[model samples]
Target: MSDANGGFRPRLRALDRRQGLAFMAALAERLRPNYLLYAEASEQGDPAALRVIHDLIWEALLVKEARIDFERQAEKLAEMEPPAEDESFGARRALEAVMALAACLDSLRGEAPEAALEVSELSRSGVQAFIELTEGEEDAQRLAALIRQHPLMDDEYDFQAAVLEAVEAPLDRGALKELRRLGRNGGVSNLGLTLD
Candidate 1:
């Protein structure tokens, strides 16, 4: 069962896919660790309503880390006026890190054996909206494009690698160092993407 957000978030409108992914990460942090996020469309029931009692211990650990990263982002963003623009290298890495963390939530989403969010679901529901309001086609396309711009070429590297690779100039080594520390130790690393 989706929240009261009118079922799947509207997909027709062009949304910032980066923002959507970030939001997904935040939502995943709120869920029980044992509980996955997406389910196959053929699933019999609501994956969201599963029992959180099974693994509160593990969930607590993941949640603690996620909360820390989330707080760090909030603090950093707060330092800037109106959140500034989104083209900064550090800023993009920060966003990608959030997206990486959010992927953890994606793993949980398709847990339901029968009710996953595969192509069939989208084909029927316009691939734009689903029973729950999250993301859709435009976001997916944007994500693909964004993925192509990764900082590091290798798959083994993570968010830190991406950020480090992208930021060629050492103009703000100190600030980058601090951010790198945060990225490496945060809940999720944006190694998949490079510094913008």
Candidate 2:
């Protein structure tokens, strides 16, 4: 389902029993450890930790919901009959949407906020490139020409590898540490200067 702004709203009620069970399993897998820690923090009355855990749970839920949507769309597309000439473009558009959702879920897998944002940006550009690739293919001849011109279209390795490579890379803790150091050292202007 979509909201008034066209943003996705999870079709929680639309899910069948199997899909609902799968969603629940994935959600629990992602949140169980955090829930344990959240419980510990709550017992100690640590508001800050409690807040972080709450945010983590919310983020996980959003990611899981998106995964279900992507899977559902892909299944629906698979069950579709062969597209007529006019309907072909809709198939391509659906592919792009599924790609975007995959990118989002991939980004969120590790619970890394920055990586999720990066993957979202990269995925959007990837889909835009796909759109541009077919923009001038108004006929079979043009599409054939496009395929010949861009052989890499047959290969998805580059983008998929990039996304996974980036997700696997460790977060830069040094940057956060440097920011804290700067804060202690009296802000940006004093970053590299000696005050002796």
Candidate 3:
């Protein structure tokens, strides 16, 4: 279920640097499958590269001394964004995944303090777009209401809440690993896309 104000932005805003990075990493892990499917279909981007970036983010979270070249990683991630002209729903979802990862990288670089909040909004927007595309609802008012009640959207809201709750605690390697698994959501995305 969605909050009336949209999402847990306030809670995300309160997170410390490490907690914020953890939050972004988990949500990006959940959305990675969307990019994987798109890359497989279009043969344009490298899913492996994206996976490497995600792994780096997780490592930074779990290992205090983990060294990552955030600038280079961000450059690589920029290459993954689908062309703006590609208006297909899959492309949109793929872009969301890429952008979410970008936000994670930005957080790691200490560039965007609100990266977690940005990822939260991206996750919810991806769900809303999926609902719009699949349900074929044209009216703005109806679509807004439908998004609130839709199971997929509910899953998104619930998943974000869970991730936020999980990241609030002190995290170690094991805890971060568990958070990654939880974000995977049993291999399904907010858009219900599965990794092949």
Candidate 2 clash total? 0
List candidate 3 segments past 4 Å from native. 1-7
Give the per-residue lDDT of model 3 (tens digit) for 41-120.
Answer: 98877888899988888888877898788999999989889888998888888988899889888877789987888788
Alpha-carbon runs more than 4 Å astray in model 1: 1-84, 111-196
- Candidate 2: misplaced stretches above 4 Å? 1-58, 61-86, 99-156, 171-196
- Lowest summed-lDDT stretch of 10 residues in model 1? 123-132
lDDT tens digits, residue span 30-145, model 1: 22121121112222222333322112212422343432333443333233211235443333323332333334334333322211122112222211221112323357667444
By TM-score rank, best first, the candidates go 3, 2, 1
lDDT of 2 by residue, 1-196 (tens): 1133223122333333322322322222222232223224334223243233323433444344532333443344333322334234333333332333333343334332343333333333443455455466678776655644553432222333332232233324343233223222331111111222
Q: For candidate 1, what is the lDDT?
A: 0.29
**In model 3, which residue pairs have backbone atoms overlapping below 3 Å?**
none
- Give all candidates' CA lDDT scores: 0.29, 0.33, 0.85
Among all candidates shown, the one with the greatest lDDT: 3
Candidates in order, TM-scores: namely: 0.22, 0.23, 0.93
lDDT of 2 at 141: 76
The residue-level lDDT of candidate 2 at 70 comes to 32
